[model samples]
Target: MLMRYVMSSLRISLLMMIVLGLGYNLLVTGFAQTVMPERANGSLILNDQAEVVGSRLIGQENRDQAFFQNRVSSIEYNGASGSPNYAPSNPDMLKRTSDAVKEWHTQNPDVQIGSLPLDLITNSGSGLDPHISPAAAEVQIPRISKLTGISPSKLKLLVNKHTEGRELGFLGEPAVNVLELNLELKSLMPE
Candidate 1:
């Protein structure tokens, strides 16, 4: 009689655990994440003979001299590389940012007037931020102009063109998506 009661209770508890576990995951992933709408429609990109190049929601990798660079990206555009976490005041973060500032300055000898953009040197907390502040984007104008043959004024216009103002006029900061700006540059640059 005692053994029978213990087995019955154990079976009941095991069944409840299985049901609740599946329910929790389904509610979070299936109902909440997948079913939700995203405001980011990826309105930026490039086309080489009509083939899509990159996503606006992802930061652009700095390589060629012609394009204005985006924020420092971790995982580097590889979806499989996974997201990077930012620990506030972490020593690693400090070291990385400090090193990047030096490297950027070393590479560009002409830029000498002001400090560098924080977003440009520091990785975004999510390691996935796709935009930079308008001011941050503006500082890169001179270098971009030198490479693309666009006037500084014209490059400023392009930066402004891609900048999105604060949400509802008060919620968020103005930002320029690098992917969109670069694609526009590709199309607008006089070949």
Candidate 2:
């Protein structure tokens, strides 16, 4: 007799839970998934037009000669490697930074960089940062000027144009997005 009462209550509770869950999904997430933006899927698509070769949201291991370089990445934008699992004393990062520093020195033999930018050496917290510090962007002006033949002053202007300040002007340092900047560069240059 007591077992029947418990079983009936249990059945009622289960029915209520199923009804509430279905109602919430249909009224909220189902509509959101249909009406809202889902650009990640589109961003992953490479149509050989807007996207040079691969997904623009992802980073390439090698820098293209014609394009401005952004931060270095260990993951190479592979979904498996995702965010770089960096140990503070990770030998691989140190070695990679060492080689990059050597190459940077080779490329800009005269410029006194003082110390390497952390962003230049480290993969961002999110692999798709899409922006770098203004200082980092500024430092590359000389090298970019050489590659693009756009005067450093002009490049500085472009960087300034693209640079975005922090929220309310006090949260974070200014950042410039490489992909966006590169697109602007393409427009400025004739095919």
Candidate 3:
């Protein structure tokens, strides 16, 4: 009787493993691939030559004067890590924020700068945020306009064009995907 009970338990466990582990995963994968193949296979951005430049899910650092920058990344734009747990009173955090502010000032010397945008100076929680708040992009308009020779009005229009609304209406604030915005800026560059 005990032997029969053990065998039955083994059979049940094996069946559950096969169904839940293998079958469930395959079903989800198949559904995702059929429904949204591009997203399923990583939303890769391609250039005109069909070369994959980057993934839409990852943030990239754009230091070029002509390109709009993303938020300060604690992981240096790497997605492998989450936000740092540094307290506001921490010297390292204070120093980093101070340095970012100074760098922004240096970059926008000619513009009439006011209070710096928080998004520009602080790292996002994931440390891999590809999007920046609209206000953050707005503040950088002067620098990008000067560097690209694109008129401020046109640049503002481009920002608006690339800006994405909150998810499903009121979930999150509007944000501009920095990678997408930079790609658009590249297209607008004088050849």
Candidate 4:
């Protein structure tokens, strides 16, 4: 009787593992692939040559004066997606923020530090966040305009064009995808 009970328990465990572990994963993957193939495949952005340039989902370092910069990334935008987890009082965090502020002042002498967006000086919880608040993008417009010779008005229009409204109309604040914005900006550059 004990032998029979043990065998029954083993059989149930195997059945559950096959059904829940393997079957569930297959079902979800199939549904996602069929329903949203582009998203399932990483939402890759392509250039005119159809070459994969980057993903709409990941952030990258953009230091060129001609382009709007992204938020400070603790992980250097390697796509690892993490924060430094520093406390508000941590000296290291304070130093990093100070350094970022100094760099911003150096790079954007025209914009006052008081008006600078917090996102420009702080790292996002996910270091790979590709979007920045619309305000953040706007704050950099003057610098980008001066460097690229694009009119400030035209750059503002571009920022507005690239800005996305909150998810489902109310979930999050408006944000501009830096990668997409930069790509469009590149086209507007003098050739």
Candidate 5:
């Protein structure tokens, strides 16, 4: 009786390990690769030379005045990591937002302080959000146009072109992928 129980337990464990561990992973990977190859492979963004610049799924810190910036990052835009996950009540979070507002003011003296979007001042949950609210992108238009010598009309057109509507028309707010927008800007300027 004891020997039979041991054999049965070993058999079940082996079966489950094979099915849940190897089989499930392989099935998901195959499905992802077939259905969405670009995203399954990290949605890498390429440059003019066709070299990978970065991934569309991750954010980057762009402090240059010529480039559109993403949200303030808690992990400094490292996709392998996550945000500090600070609460709004935390004094550190308050300080960070306050400092960011000051920096934005210092950077764009012409843009009104009240006009700045909250998304631009706060870090996203993952600290790796590649997209920003359309309002956030719009707030930076004047500064980007002034620095890049791109016309406001043309920049607004570019912003519109890159703007993505809410998923299913009623889900999330409209957003613009900052990395894509900045890459397009680089292509236009080609520095």
Candidate 6:
């Protein structure tokens, strides 16, 4: 009777493992692939040549002056997704913020440091946020226009085109996807 009970327990454990681990995962994957294939596949953004450039979901580093810059990413936009979480008075945070401000001043001399958006000089909570507030994008327009020779009016139009509204109309603030914006900006540039 003890041998039979042990066998039954083993069988039940194996069945549960197969059902919950394997079967559940497969079902969710299949459902996701069928219902939202693009998202399930990482929402990859492809270029005109069909090359996989980047994902619409992850933020990436863009230091080229011609393109609008993304927010400071503590992880260097590696997509590992974390923040330093430094306190306001932390010396490391202070130094990092000071360095970022200095770099912004150097890069954007025409825009006053005070006028710069806070997001431009700070890392996002996730350190991989791809969207910047529209105000942040606007402040960089002059620099991008100067570098790329795109008219400020046209750049403004482009920014407007790429600006995404708040989720479901009120869940969050409106944001601009930097990757998508830069892709469109590239199209306007001469090869």
Off by over 4 Å in 3: 111-113
Candidate 4 global TM-score: 0.93
Q: What's the CA RMSD for each of the models? A: 4.6, 4.5, 1.7, 1.5, 1.5, 1.0
In candidate 4, what are the lDDT values of residues 6-120, reduced to their tens digit?
A: 9999999999999999999999999999999999999999998999989999998987888989999999987687998999899999999999999999999999999999999
Task: List the global CA lDDT of all models.
Answer: 0.75, 0.70, 0.88, 0.93, 0.89, 0.93
lDDT of 6: 0.93
In candidate 5, how many Å is residue 161 off? Answer: 0.6
Point out where model 4 deviates above 4 Å: none
Scored by lDDT, model 2 comes in at 0.70
Expressed as tens digits, the lDDT of each residue in 26-133 for candidate 5 is 999999999999999999999888999998888888879888989998888655667778889999999999999999999889889898999999987788899999
Comparing 2 with 4 on lDDT, the higher-scoring candidate is 4
Selected candidate, larger lDDT, 2 vs 3 = 3
What is candidate 3's lDDT per residue for 1-191, written digit by digit as tens? 99999999999999999999999999999999999999999999998899998888788887887789889999997558698779999999999999998898899886554667889889988888888988888888888888889999998998999889999998999999888888888999999
lDDT of 1 by residue, 1-191 (tens): 99999999999888878778776766666654455534233444548776667676666576876887777766675553444465758788778877878877875657753567677787775666779989778888878888778899988998988999988999988999887788888887887
Better of 3 and 6 by lDDT: 6
Residue 178 displacement (Å), model 6: 0.6
State in Å the error of residue 171, model 2: 2.2
Misplaced by over 4 Å in model 1 are 1-50, 80-89
- For model 3, what is the alpha-carbon lDDT of residue 66? 76
Give the lDDT of residue 47 in candidate 6: 98
